[model samples]
Target: MGLFIFNSSIGRKLIMSISGLALILFLLFHSIMNIFVIFSPEIYDAICKFLGANWYALIATMGLAFLFVVHIVYAFWLSLQNYIARGKERYAVKKNAPGVDWASQNMLVLGAIVLGFIALHLFNFWYKMQLQELLAKLNGEVLHVEGAALVQELFASPVYCLLYIVWLVALWFHLTHGFWSALHSLGGSNTVWLPRIKVISNIFSTVIVLLFMAIPVYYLIINLLG
Candidate 1:
């Protein structure tokens, strides 16, 4: 069973679907946590401090990273397989399949864009806060950076704010396609559920994206007005 799961095409898609769904849940939680920063810095900082390099937080972070890596690797592998299976005919017949939307067809490109931004996001925020906290522990020195302040500091800059907006937009496109596709991969492939899943994916992804994008736009407007 284990061997088949690792070696079979359906098994690979199943793994991707599970990992993708897990990451989407993480994103939803993260988006809500960031929203708290807009309301009360104290609350957000407390949450961040609690999560800062603690044993449980570290474990969770490691798990999240594993899911991300698995999702990406499987996605690349599956897309490559599909491309090769189609050969040159892929570009010929269904560059834009009749029912496939742009986002669906361009999912690999969207995923790449989102993956790049995820790195930038980790550097800008994670390196400053949790990584510092972890490093400080190694040196036997106390150090904690309030994540709320980090959000404000980065979003205060128009350029950074705009860059985040771009990332969020890319994320929206990625999630819209990925969410439904994940559902289908996970056994929602019946004709009855197909259209319904797409609608659910679009609505849910939009809500998540808006929640995340709101922070930067809020800060950008505040900075401009100030």
Candidate 2:
């Protein structure tokens, strides 16, 4: 069974589906927590402090990282496998099939864009906060980790704020397509459920991205007004 899962396309697709959904859930949780930065930064900082350099939080972060790596690997593996299975037909220029959206067709491109932004985000935020704290703890050094202050300082720059908007847009496109695709692979492929799940995907992606986008937008407003 383990070998089948490692070697079979279906099993790889199943792993992708489950891991993608798990990441979506994590995004939802993180997005809601992030919104506190806009309204009540104290709450946001408190939350960050609670999660910083703690054993439980570190464990959860590692687990999340593992899921992300597995999902990414399977995604590339499946894409390559599909390309190989298509043989020479992959080069044929054909019109879009009915019901296949643009995002579905260009998922690899969108995934690449999203992946790039994720690295930027981790560098700007995670490296400054959780990673710094982890390092300080390891060396018995002292450091302040105020995530809210860090967010505001970074987003205060019009350039960074604009970059965040671009990132969120890419993320929205990726999620809207990936959410439905993941569900379809899991069991929503039937005629009755696919369209319904697609609608949910749009809503879910919009809400999560909008929540994350709000912080940057709010900071942009402040910068403009001041």
Candidate 3:
């Protein structure tokens, strides 16, 4: 059974579906928490402190990392498999149908760009919050000012703010396609439901992306225009 899954295209798509759904849930929770920043940075910091370097949070982090690795690896693997199956004849197929075709064709490239930026994102935020907490616990010092201060520091730089905006743009594109496609892969795509799911997916993705993107932009604008 394991070998069958490893060798089958459908198996790869299944993996993508599961991982994509997991990521969407994570993003939704994450966006909600980030909204706390807009209201009160202290409240956001408190939430960060609660999550801290706790064992549960650590486990969740490990699980997320594993999901990300599996998703990215299979994405590339599937792309290579498809390309090999098509050979040079892939370029020969010019015109194509819409729907799943475009996203499936470019998912590998999109996944790579998203994964690359995610590493930078973790370094900027996760390393500061979690890793710093671990180090503080080991060294008998405080964990420092928390996620809010780090965010403010990063956003204080116009260059970093612009870079964050660019990264969020990539994230927007990724989520817009990924959101409902994951559901469709899980068998939600029917004649009656696919179009509706697509609309909802795009709207959800846009709202989440804008919420996240607004943080840096708000800080940047306030800093510059004040």
Candidate 4:
């Protein structure tokens, strides 16, 4: 039964839906956490320290990695399948068939952009901070990095700040479609609720992305002024 469900298209979509929802939830939590930096750097750093290199945090990070892998792999798999199924004719159909949202049609491209930026973000923050601490622990040294300092340093550069904003734009586009689509896939949407879901999705996506974007923007202003 497990193999059967995983092997089928509907089941694959179900997996995508579930994984996407899980990621959205994580993003919500992460956004709220990030918002702390704008108002209280000390509190933000404290929270970061609390989540750093501990066993529970490490386990949670691993689980988050698993969810990301599952989501990305399934997304590409489904996209390839759809492309092949649609064949060359899919491109010929230039006009959108009425109700299709722009984001719905370009989800794959947006997702790819989001994935690429995620790598950049992880390298900038995670590699320098959490992973550094983990390595130090293994080497028998205690290292505590200031997360707020890292944020300020990274956002001080105009290029990095611009790239981050671009990344957030892509993320916004991806979530605008993904939020409602995931619910639709899980049987929480219908014609009657579709409009409402889309509105909610947009609001949710915008709020989350803005909360995240605030940190970088705040630091950029601070650095420029000083």
Candidate 5:
């Protein structure tokens, strides 16, 4: 039964939907945590400490990594299957498809952009913070650093701030389409709910992206003024 589901087209889509939804939930939690940095760096650092390099946090991170890999691999598999099924007429059909948002039609491309930025983000923050702490623990050395200070330092650079803004824009576009599409794939949307879901997706994506974008913008302005 499990193998059958893994081999079916619908089952693949279900995997995508489930994995996408899980990532969305993580983004919501992360955005909320990032918002705290704007108002109280101390509070944000405290929250970071709470989540840092602990057993539970490590487990959660591993789970999150698994979900990302599943979603990405399935996405590429589906895209290839679609291309093969469409054959030489794929572009012709896509060009004629009306009422489809640009983001919806180019989810794979958007996803690639998002994935690239995610690597950059991991290097900028995760590698420097959580991974560093984990390494220190393994080495039997104590290493403590304030999460907010690292954030401020990175965002102080204009180039990094600009790159982050670009990344957030790509993320906004990706989420706007992915959010509704995932729900639709899960049978939660129809003709009646389609427009409603689209609206809700837009609003939700905008809010989440804005919350995240605010951190870099805030620190950029502070660096400029200070």
Candidate 6:
């Protein structure tokens, strides 16, 4: 069964759907948490400490990493299969033709850009928090810079903040399309549920992305004024 999912077209797509849904839920929760950073740094730091390198957090982190790898690998595999199936006819399709959001046609490219930002983000934040905890235990040290300090340091720089906003914009487009498509792939598309799910997907994706984008925008404005 697992092998089939890794190999079959429909099964591969289902994997993408399930993992995409999981990531979307995580993004919603993460965006809410980020909002706290703007509203109350103390409260946000407390929340971060609560989620610190604990057993449950470790498990969730591992699950998120697994999902990311599987979802991306399968996306590439599916795209490759699609290209193969279409054969030379793929070339006949116009590049960047009208009526298509460049993002929709180049999801893989956007995903790659997003992945690059994720690596930078993990290094900037996750490694500082979680890996610092591990190293502190090993070498008898303390992790001083918590969530709020990290956020302030990163967003203090205009260049990094601008890059983050660009990444968030890409994420918005990616989620808007993927969210509804995932539901449809999962058999949520019927006479009644199809249109409803599409609308819900757009609203949910937009809200989550906007919340995330707001954090960087807020900090950038503050830093620029000062």
- Between candidates 2 and 3, name the one with more favorable lDDT: 2
What is candidate 5's lDDT per residue for 28-129, written digit by digit as tens? Answer: 999999999889988999989988888999999999999999999999999999888877753544354577788887899989999999999999889998
Compared with the true structure, what per-residue lDDT tens digits does model 4 show for residues 1-226?
7884468998898999899999999999999998887789899999999999899999999999999999999988999999898877556557668887888999989989999999999999899989999999999998888988888778889889889889999899999999999999889988899899999999999999999888778767777798
Cα lDDT tens digits, model 1, 1-226, are 7875578987888898899999999999999998999999999999998999799999999999999999898889889888888777434443555776788888889999999999999999999988999999999988878888888888889999999999999889989999998889778778888889999999999999999999999999999999
Model 2 off-target regions past 4 Å?
89-92
Give the range where candidate 5 is weakest over 10 consecutive residues by summed lDDT. Answer: 89-98
The RMSD (Cα, Å) of candidate 1 is 1.6
Q: lDDT of each model, Cα atoms only?
A: 0.90, 0.89, 0.82, 0.90, 0.91, 0.86
Which residue pairs in candidate 2 collide?
A: none
lDDT of 1 at 61: 98
Cα displacement (Å) at residue 83, model 6: 1.6
Model 4, residue 207: what's the lDDT? 99
lDDT for model 3, please.
0.82
Model 6 misplacement above 4 A: 89-102, 140-144
Least accurate stretch of 10 residues (summed lDDT) in model 6? Answer: 88-97
Candidate 6 Cα lDDT to native? 0.86
* Reference-based TM-score of each model: 0.95, 0.94, 0.90, 0.95, 0.94, 0.92
RMSD of each: 1.6, 1.5, 2.1, 1.5, 1.7, 2.1
TM-score of 3: 0.90
For residue 160, model 2's alpha carbon misses the true position, in angstroms, by: 1.0
Off by over 4 Å in 4: 88-93
Error at 195, model 4, angstroms: 1.6
State the TM-score for model 6.
0.92
Per-residue C-alpha lDDT of model 3 across residues 67-112, encoded as one tens digit per residue: 8888888877877887788776546457776545455466667677
